[model samples]
Target: MAAAFLPPSLITVIWGFIGIVCPLFAKGPNKGIIQCCLMLTAACCWLFWLCCYMTQMNPLIGPNLSRHSILIIAKEWGNEITNTTTT
Candidate 1:
């Protein structure tokens, strides 16, 4: 597991490198599937990032969130940014 203290962007760079290398080593259908999964993951990460930005800019979208819930969301935002990997 990666140290939580590391910047999320660093993790993203590592994962992106791994994703690229994986497809290079893979063959045929496996390569295609891995690439597709990576693309889907990248998309979801982007969507998560967008949601976090919107929520931060406009808390009125969900005013009932407790402090703990807000913290959870913040952690998720970091995770999302770290999830991207190029395949």
Candidate 2:
């Protein structure tokens, strides 16, 4: 059910390909804009996922309760880490 809320594969694949190419290309304003836009879009996606998860998993329960939430959170956090580590 929540899968419906996910970003499309085309969007992801395009972003991934761009991500791979961006580094090889010279650093410039366009590259920075693309990077920023991608990160912003990813963050917004994670937030939407988190909201959907919370709605679906109301009264969350389990051993690593919130595991799904953690995954989403990690994705968001990872962007920050990668940006910092890479640049």
Which candidate number maximizes TM-score? 1
The TM-scores, one per candidate, come to 0.39, 0.36
Give candidate 1's TM-score: 0.39
Alpha-carbon shift of residue 48 in model 1 (angstroms): 0.9
lDDT for model 1, please.
0.62
Residue 50 deviation, candidate 1, in Å? 0.7
**Backbone clashes, each candidate:** 0, 0
lDDT of 2 by residue, 40-72 (tens): 666576567567766775666645647567666
Q: Model 1 off-target regions past 4 Å?
A: 1-29, 61-87
Each prediction's Cα lDDT score?
Answer: 0.62, 0.59
